[model samples]
Target: MTDRRPLVAGNWKMNGLSAAAAELDALAKALADRPAPACDVMIAPPFTLLAPFVAAASGTPIAIGGQDCSHLEPGAHTGDIAAVMLRDIGATSVIVGHSERRQDHHETDDLVRLKAEAAHEAGLVAIVCIGETEPERDRDQTLNVVTTQLAGSVPDAATADNTIIAYEPVWAIGTGRTPTAADVATVHGTIREVLVERFGEDIGNGLRILYGGSVKPANAGELMAVANVDGALVGGASLKAADFDGIIDAYR
Candidate 1:
């Protein structure tokens, strides 16, 4: 088997409130029952819920993270939360360059790289997301686009400890659609090759690559078992404890 460890990261996106910590509490309890999961598990919730969730999952192995963090230097950025701020709030990881941020905030690959760098500076693992739009996929530009984004968005300093890659087809996120296992294998293999070329064999091969886009319990087994797919970056299914655990069980 590959040296990469499986990493299942739940991205809560812009959803959740204080009341949502119950799910985190439940997940923490479940994790307590199984002290050692075969893979690492993470939950990136909305910023508003991080504190409460962290408090709720105090002694458990359930890691909490942020959906996004400001890449800008520490300063008065109004609504922006700096990477260090995320660290201060007990976030062990953060997702950078998510498609929603890319499309909605007009974040370029350069900006995403800066954010990832910032996350590393603050001692947080950065889960960088890359994907092709429906049109781009249809145009057969998926590989080219993804490789370009991978080169630009992934910092030269990335290491297994500080960086994770998630491939989420734009049209598939929350749409209940997914690429075939062969398709996932092809893309993930391509990504690994690029990583090995850019970062060298050892470092590149050890970085975890996760599949995202409508990931649910029913489809997780096949997706997780793909040649280069180390785990999943779950969305809606992650919002519920039962659903997320089921997805995590794919590794089991």
Candidate 2:
């Protein structure tokens, strides 16, 4: 059994507004009386509502994270928030190398590594995402693609404290499709091997490997039960309090 604590993280994407207030309220209430999990719980909301959410989450066990951040710390970069700035705003972590950023903005693994380094430098945990498209999987190159991404995107200084690896199959992001249990185990095990080879057993074994791609309350329990899957990087299902709370309950 893995000693790493499970982490259930909700990615709100570009959605949420004042209407999100109600959702957060529901989340707070749902978890209020419930015992906190042995693992971590976090939510990534749009920058606009981060402060509000952070304030609301204060005194609770929930953590606030950013969906993305600029590689540069602070500068003339337009429409970009830096890792340091995120920490200053009370964000405990940031998601880097998401498939959306890769597809929409054409971000490369090198850029992701730099961003992760920035997050680590600024004292925030960086959730570095890696995944393969459907074509890659069809061609049986899923492992190859993910290995390259894990090597290129993650920084050399990655430690259990400052880094997390999120394996999000690009094909499954919002397609309502998920890989089979065997498939998830294969990929997560492979990732763990890669981490161990590069970072040594102690650091590698301590690092949390999170599974993403169409994760929901329905499948959370089985997925979390799998080997090496220490957490989840939830997408659509995380928007609602009930759904996310259900996902969290899977760890129990």
Top-TM-score structure, candidate number: 2
TM-score of each: 0.97, 0.98
lDDT tens digits by residue: candidate 1, 1-252:
367889988998888888888888788777767546688888988888888877776777778899998988788789999999899989899999999999999999999999999999999999999999999999999999999999899999999889999999998999999999999999999999999898998888989999999999999998998998999999999999989998988877
Tell me the TM-score of model 1. Answer: 0.97
Task: Please name the candidate that would achieve the greatest lDDT relative to the true structure.
Answer: 2
Report lDDT (CA) for all predictions.
0.91, 0.94
Per-residue CA lDDT of model 2 for 54-129, tens digit only, reads 9999988889999999999698999999999999999999999999999999999999999999999999999999
Return the lDDT, model 1, position 92.
Answer: 97
- Which residue runs does candidate 1 get wrong by more than 4 Å? 34-36
